[model samples]
Target: MYTIPKTSTTDMEVTSIRLEKELKDRLKKLANNKGYQALIRDILWTYVQQKSGDYQPQLSNSDIRASLPATAQQEERCVLTGKVIRPSEGMLLGLTNNGDMVPLSIDSLED
Candidate 1:
């Protein structure tokens, strides 16, 4: 007789997300034996994989530099914070939800 192997999910990091009560109920109804957590995790993993496959960071250094706004090129006020950053000061460029690249101060960003 062969025994089934147990799968381990212990190595995965746990995180919480807020969802609407109605949506939660709907997910629970559809989850059946898999449970809501597993269903949500599978959905998120699929989404991440799909999005990752679509992403291509092929921009050259000169292309990136040319894409920046005049203010960012001059290293003036930060796009997100509006705080003045000198040209010599260290700054980070981040992509916004609108797909536009914006300059930000390193201090304003979270790890």
Candidate 2:
């Protein structure tokens, strides 16, 4: 599973900014049917994540597992962490308590 870091915007105060009429029109067209505010929020969030080195490309368990060597796959350990995982452990990805995702074996994953 891919987790997107979220910051609560419920109590966020609204602020206004001015943009060129041409730029605003371009943004409106790029936003498709979504509200301009939402589009801007998403764009800013992605930028922040990239700048902070917090953006991680989401990959499926199969993709991660396939990248490992056959011996590692047969051992049922996380390719990144080399941590032994039991077959009953839940989650397809090797997620630590700190919420970092790592490559793990699909056979060891719990339903």
Candidate 3:
């Protein structure tokens, strides 16, 4: 295992991030010798990548919340079968000739 010398590195000012209790517990449990700071840095870097469109991180609660389109409370239905499907979840459900309604993720839906 590689070791980083504890010789005091140059200090950088850090702003406080308020992680939820559940997230904190999970991070503390998963952290290794590299520790919580490393994990936090990696997480922030991933978010940066996502913001810059350089990388596609797995969708998170923040991403979903931010991407949500304005909508109203009304039942939506399939034009063919008249089956109720919620638009908030942004599903792509379709029935084949065999009459199987296959549900697809929003990202997979092609324009």
Candidate 4:
């Protein structure tokens, strides 16, 4: 036997933003092809989560340290903190604080 948890639902105020002509045209097309309101709702949800700094992917420490292809690793810095990123890509391997070398992905940093 399994039990399910109950959750509470809350009401939210909806606000609209004025999009530029080009963007609005594209959005209108997308909404017509798909459900516009649903598309907008998903976009808004992601935007709000990112703005609130509450967005986190469920990943473990070992998951974060997975190997990258010989390519992809690159030096990156924390945008908010500006700390130097160790080399994870390139011919040279990055030395971790624990003295372990890890491959870094330059492309992943852009994301």
- The most accurate candidate by lDDT is 1
Give the alpha-carbon lDDT of every model.
0.56, 0.53, 0.47, 0.45
Sort every candidate by lDDT, greatest first: 1, 2, 3, 4
| Runs off by more than 4 Å, candidate 3 | 1-11, 56-111
Model 2: pairs clashing at backbone N, Cα or C within 3 Å: none
Q: Is candidate 2 or candidate 3 better by TM-score?
A: 2
The runs of at least 3 residues in candidate 1 whose Cα sits more than 4 Å from the true structure, single-residue gaps closed, are 1-7, 54-111
The lDDT, on a scale of 0 to 1, for candidate 3 is: 0.47
Tens-place lDDT digits, model 1, residues 27-56: 999889978887787667544533454322
User: How many pairs in model 4 have backbone atoms within 3 A of each other, for residues 3 or more apart or on separate chains, i.e. clashes?
Assistant: 8
List CA RMSD, all candidates.
14.0, 11.7, 13.6, 12.0
TM-score of each: 0.41, 0.43, 0.38, 0.34
Pairs of residues clashing in candidate 3: none
Q: Give the deviation of candidate 3 from the true structure as CA RMSD.
A: 13.6
User: For model 1, how many clashes?
Assistant: 0
Better of 2 and 4 by lDDT: 2
**What is the overall TM-score of model 1 with all chains considered together?**
0.41
Residue 29 displacement (Å), model 4:
2.9
- Over 1-111, each residue of candidate 3 has an lDDT whose tens digit, in order, gives 112234343564667889899988888787767688767766676556534545432322222212222232344433233234455655444444444444334443233
Worst 10 residues of 3 by lDDT: 59-68
